[model samples]
Target: MGVAAPAASATPTDVAPDAVAAPPGDNLALTPPMGFNNWNSTHCRPEFNEEMVRGIADLFVESGLKDAGYEYVNLDDCWALPERDENGKLVPDPERFPSGLDALGDYIHSKGLKFGIYTSAGTKTCNPAGFPGALGHEVSDAQQFADWGVDYLKYDNCNNQGVDAVERYTAMRDALAATGRDIVYSICEWGQNQPWTWAQDVGHLWRTTGDITDTWDSVMSIFKRNVELAEYAGPGHWNDPDMLEVGNGGMTDTEYRSHFSLWAMMAAPLLIGSDLRVASEETFDILGNTEVIAVDQDPLGRQGTVVSSENGAWVLSKEMADGSRAVALFNESDTAQHVGTTAEAVGLPAADAYEMRDLWEHESYQTAGTISATVPAHGIEVFRVSPDGDWAQYPSAVEVGASAVQSEAGTTAELTTAVTNLGRTPAKSVSVDVAGPEGWTIEAGSATTSPALATDAALTTDWTVEIPPGTPGGSYDLTVTADYRSPRHQPRQDSLTVEAQVLVPPGEGTSYVSDLAFVREANGQGPVERDTNVGSVAAGDGTPITIEGTVFDKGLGTHAPSTVEIYTAGRCDVFSAQVGIDDAAGAGGGPPQRGSVTFEVWADGTRVAATGVLNGTAPAQPLTADVSGASFVELVVTDGGNGKNSDHADWADATVSCTA
Candidate 1:
């Protein structure tokens, strides 16, 4: 009935409490721990008695979670008494744990699983006035758990304060090692200190952040931070972002999927923190996604990294066992955007055709050396890449339609080019260099561009740039190249031909586009758009469009909202746009419908050149905004309602148009 127990700490070396213990076997690391924790479900009152433990063990067996690779059964803090035995041995809280510690251990072992417990480096347990133990008691406690055949220890740092907190944990680690038992120590310090750099020497895994709540933002934020610690995780140690809240209330199933996907990519501990005795079927499916789990347990053990990001959308990639790569297109925006990937980014080929297996949709895509797909907002598309031919036998595919488009506000060209991968395995870091045809100089957004090609992935590289005024307009030819490092070959390069046409100084017409789509509704249903296009314009493919109408929003005196996202197809690689509004005076705090506020959206960072101003109140006249160059468009009104109420704002007559 209470939250299931948390596992034992996984570091028990004879050094300081924070010293990393020898890794627990290759077993746990092979697939982040898939068990559960008690903190999210029961908080401070999780019951860890023998009977409760047995019930959870039964659920683990019956739910087929054990068959799905879930092992360790852990207990968080609060199972100990305030006093120890005369011989400096630890004692169980008599009223809570009537059976001897050994009996509980034997029962868990009898269930064909492992058992774990919790403790703190401070003088008290998680309870401010409860049973907390310092050095001697800490060591003695580890000995007791070890003597009882515990497999893991979750060492929390609640109520412990000092400048050298890491050192304090290290002391307990040494004490545990003295017992001669191989117990995995888990450091639950809540990321107060940067544990990644040092926790490896102290425990098997360390909590990389504060506790996680069952909210979408909570899950996303934790994951965002985990990416920052990718370099510090490896075979013996992992980053623990607390535990999973998959079955807990608050977030939706899609949100949980995102949570799981991100954790797997980060190669973090897979401890579940929910009530499993009666979890829903949806929760079971999420917990049992073996394909996604495979990526997490990839033998390389290298955590996924963010190669690039705009707004909240992220491009994550991980190395696989066969020297191939797994790439993920992710959308983190509140709305939706377009998402896509190329072979070069995955380290494949630039001149040869390739093939891709979309993990999420369970489909296959073939490209003439480049690959691309559209993703929705807050959604993801995971794919496995393999080579289509010999790494050295193929020739670079022909490049096509290389061109540059520039933003009026800056000196950068939005370069669009088509390139291909010729080799077999996937390619990593496909890129292009931008310069003027001859005397013209490249400015702003233009930088080195590379396409991530997976075996036969063929896609276009879409990039943008800002051009400085007074630059002469003329015809210029630019070179586009695909640089990649495949699993079978050292590194290779290919090229494309591009012709830039900078129009004469325009003193007449202004042009642009904003594509629109219906991403979500008020039903609390997760966004219909892909996770990778929450705030971009590609929608799904790299197409162009023009805009010619006026856009307006009516803001209440106290509230205003202004944010929009564009999506292309179901993928999230090409959608992009932005919106903005004039700041109204005397606006109070709240939702957009209740008051005056600023609203705005941007496309490829151009602020959408328009004649009308963003108004906090109704537009001077009914204005129709024309959107172009986007696969889909999303609109958002900030401060739509007063903090205390909902339904304060309304949107109407919004329309979208694309290239003819």
Candidate 2:
């Protein structure tokens, strides 16, 4: 099979030849289509049948995703039959899809959701076991999809070697329009030929990078890469950074939230590629974050950009429609970090008191100078800052901080107040006033403090408040007022509020397995890596496998042999890890331009799995073998594949399956 491999284009301009007919009527994706696609979770597996799609559609309705504006449920590669019918029209795989595509589409539409299908622009589809190709029959296939009630089309570029991308994609765009159906066209040419500059006329969104494997490197790389192309994305068309890998596992909740936040800021389509039927409540909530979703679907349609970034802490700011700004403080580093930037840096009107709403925590903060936070590792803090509309006539420096400590109901809860001056002027006498809810035992703290506050300095105090046992387990807000006077001026008054939540006692749960059973080989690249945190791991392995993304502590400087080793004291059946050339280290264009790595895996000095050459463009594979009787496993990656040419390999999500 001669697959038409494509390359990504970084050039700024597109070579648009001619324009095609506009899509029928406007119900199609005006903004990047918010939907779910099945590819990241289902790799054309046999178990992915129509019932699963219907069940996912049901979940879309039940989980409030449909109401939140996620409209399409798409199936990627392998849903098609091996060949077209006598009429040369694409057909669904009868064995896997007993109800056929028409019935499936009807079922999806019956639930108020749209249905989408996938095809390739080349001679043959990418599916190793699916339909032949849709190139020559673009017209017939488009008509056939419309006939079957298709609402969206994912046009891939597999097997389209030697063919011009603009010619191919534009032809399909015209064919879809000729069919008299309003289908949202999606171009998946792996960003070859700079689709961003040209895809506006052909598709609603176009993939701007290679297929996203679930990994922190992969996700963060795409995030950083796509945000730079903000000017290219717009209202009708968007820069598709591939589908989302959320809930597919291989990542902590923090990384996934960062992923979602980054994608939202970039104006990328929010396409869930996970099993919605089995999604956890946490996953459901992340996908249905209406505030974050609003940023992605903003009517202004302006993609976000990194306004400020340093030392793995990045701030992406997006301009919203209502003159507000969406800001995300992302900590890409493995350790927690304190990141901050001026409100003006994130596009807020200068020196004005703005109301900043924490989208994730659903809280509000009023600040005049800067937006700042101490973010967790692999976590993000997103906020929407809008002018309080009561624009400060005279800018002041002092800020009264109000915060609450959450505790179980019937227990003592803590309230905290701090005074901070972000402005130049400081107050000589600083005092705080506190108020509690009705009928609650409010043991307040000292109302005033003696310490004079200076610029950028802070003073804090705490109060112990007893929450009544009969009070409901929910959040309570305490009103706080601050009275302070500048040594050179008169007393001024401003008020702020702090919120605390009372929780219910948790129930006793069954014993669970702890991560203490896993041990590192002392040279693991970073920390314990979730399978999805490293690029080479399976898309949805769900099992966290340790990975080595770097060959050296400071990064790839010298080309040396890299290895990942792990051992199990108990009985283990299998050992596995996804292997590929790491993009993070190799993208730097260091020595050895072409990455070539050959890995030989051993168990107790016995060679069990020997892989061929691995590189970046090549699809990463899971290197696994039976080590049922072995006590130790060793994976040696050598540069001998192409004689030490940037052989930075990622033994992503390495782990062993214990028989115990």
**Number of the top TM-score candidate:** 2
Per-residue lDDT of candidate 1, residues 245-323 (tens digit): 8888667676687788888888887887777766889998888777777788777788888867887767887777776
Candidate 1 Cα misplacement greater than 4 A, ranges = 1-31, 46-49, 82-89, 93-96, 349-355, 361-372, 388-660
lDDT by residue for model 2 (548-596), tens: 3333111111122544444443356665656666654444353334577
Q: Looking at candidate 2, what is the lDDT of residue 317? A: 89
Prediction 1 global C-alpha lDDT: 0.57
TM-score of each: 0.58, 0.66
Cα lDDT computed for each candidate against the true fold: 0.57, 0.70
What TM-score would you give candidate 1 relative to the actual structure? Answer: 0.58
